[model samples]
Target: VSSIIVPITNVMNDQYCYQTSKKIRQVFDYKRRNGQYIGSNPPFGYVKDAKDRHHLVIDPDAAEIVRLIFSLLLKGTSKRGISFYLNEHGIPSPSVYKLEKGMTVSNKPDGNTLWSGRMIHTILTNPMYTGDLVQGRFRVKSYKVHQIETVPEEEWVRVADTHEAIIDKATFEKVQELLLRDTRTSPQGRTVHLFSGFLKCADCGRAVTRCSGKNNVYYACATYKSRSRNACTMHSISHARLEAAVLYAIRQQVHLAVSYSEVIAQINSAPIKKNQSFRLDDTIHAKERELAKVTRYKQSLYQDWKDGEITQQEYRDMKATYDRQINEVSDVLARLTAERAELANGVDKEHPALVAFKKYQNIDALSRELLIELVDHIKVYENGNISVKFKFADQLRRIAEYIDVNTAESPAWAV
Candidate 1:
């Protein structure tokens, strides 16, 4: 009916088609603004709740599989290894599982129900696993055309705590780090060597390459590998020696972060705007509570109208009143929330940056996840000496010089 009407209205050169399209988009935007999941399908680990299809609930079986994939990846298992493990154990692939649940899925020729590295990779990297409802990732180019275009990431509609998380945010973030971090895979697509692109020759400033087998693993300068020792020395470092040193340095960095308060103390003679910040925080919470209450009341009014307890005109007027109040409260809430975030946006002992390192003190085994989190690079020298530069290494020096020396701190410092 929509297709027939649109083309027919266009023949008459009327505004009807355009107006109809605009109204449809308005409804979609309103639903999106209200945090509704407007997609036809929930993500792999989730299922649409029976009570409300727009709401998502954890599918325990699929969610368990998702968790297992993340766990294996964090433990330094390659995507290929994960795929093989799942397939070898006769575990159904995501597509197969989706088919079993009566959702649309496809299988390839020969009835082989094997999981591939690509499939495992997609699951590991999906942000939806972290309890965030991420939609609007793709959209039609226009109302007239059906071609789908990838929406800019910034434009994605995301809502947090929409459903139970299959994996923690930390784990999800770590997986993303691993994906984007400069790392190489072996013949079997496993990262046999932990420090791949991160290792460079000290003298030549070239990346070090991993050469040799299980009996002896070594990272030699890339220049030497390409042009032999004339261009650069081996800068040879055994995996064991490099791993042990780098691991120790990372733990020290975490320990250093613990005492960062001393540096902060020099900057702030008095405690942070304790009273003002505290009050602002309290006010933000109160406003949020008010917003929730108003939203619930507005929803109740809709039911009241449906039950004929209120006239349609009265319902409309009440809803408009509630919506106006919601908008005013939301504006205040956004401003205060932004101010609070600005005040609290640095690495403390409790910050995820430092907390990640603090969680692993002993460092019995080094994984790529921890390596990328802590170290920026490892430079190997010809004389078998190596140095590990950590991520945010510059931040420590800046923290020590907390007062910008030339400029006084902003009054918002106590924000």
Candidate 2:
């Protein structure tokens, strides 16, 4: 009886291992097959074939249009603006071009050819534009793994000057710099005012959007503008007035920063006291541990659902709760990390905002970049205090707090 039982158990264990290995292999195979094909041969104007390892020739006209589109994108046109421009001129998108070329392409509104942010970003970032053909930047570790790992930059196989330059190297670099900078306003469907989407009408709880009046732009509560009778008052603020106030506040902050530079310099020159260093290190470690725990909890909740241990509703509710907690914790962790970094580096005497403000300070006129970098919002509070939040207010506050704690004298510029 013991011998029979032992053999049965051994068979069951072997079968279980085989089944698990088979499932793992299937997942691995799927991942290996799922990635975009990157080959030594140049596809030029076409995507790789679905099954065969050959370039499917694209329409010549369409290819020309692609080059044109890339050129415009590299010239720093926003994706939505590009889309509008293309559609307005009756320029055939890639999908339309394919269709016209006798290819049976899907006729969806946002088909394979829609000019989207991701598409524009990809084109701009693609080293291919710089005459460097890079392939296989991403790959699956195994056939069973669903996760794709990015290959490091140094490992990328790059063939230099593989194609004719649509955008020059200088212009491409400038576009990349712009992309890296946080200068993008809301999309084209939204208003163009730098403060349009940023500002919220305190009373109406809607975006303070721009309206044209007597050839001047004024911000009005969107909700009140639409539903005048039912909603709150318009709470309109003149664009000139709002812009002036925001700029003034930013200027004041910059002035304060400049004035406080002596204190900042002194602080940087001062020796890092053991207690202060320990405090910063401790705070960072604690925040890191908290972040890890939250992440683990979030992962475990997902795993529970994947394992069929939790019902859909339960999973959603738990996930939402965990997500909110995780977000709050993440924000805290970020703040702590920033604080630690500042402590470690001896915070720059001149903040980026201060430097930017100084450059534009002499101009006497506000540009879009200046507005974006300096101002966060110009909120028309219900209490009648037009609160102007500067973009670097949090950093300023942190600096003030650090100064107060570390030094005997109060920083004269602390606001």
Best by TM-score: 1
Instruction: Report the lDDT tens digits of candidate 1 across residue range 9-58.
Output: 77766566667878987887777767677877677788888998888899
Model 1 residue 15 CA deviation (Å) reads 6.4
Clashes of 2: 6
Off by over 4 Å in 1: 1-19, 103-112, 190-192, 201-206, 213-215, 223-234, 254-355, 392-415
Q: Kindly report which residue pairs in candidate 2 clash with one another.
A: 27-143, 27-144, 28-143, 28-144, 29-143, 131-161
Candidate 1: residue pairs that collide: none
lDDT (Cα, 0-100) at 44 in candidate 2: 32
lDDT of 2 by residue, 283-378 (tens): 768877887887788788878988999988898998898788878878887887777567555556776645655555455656555554566666
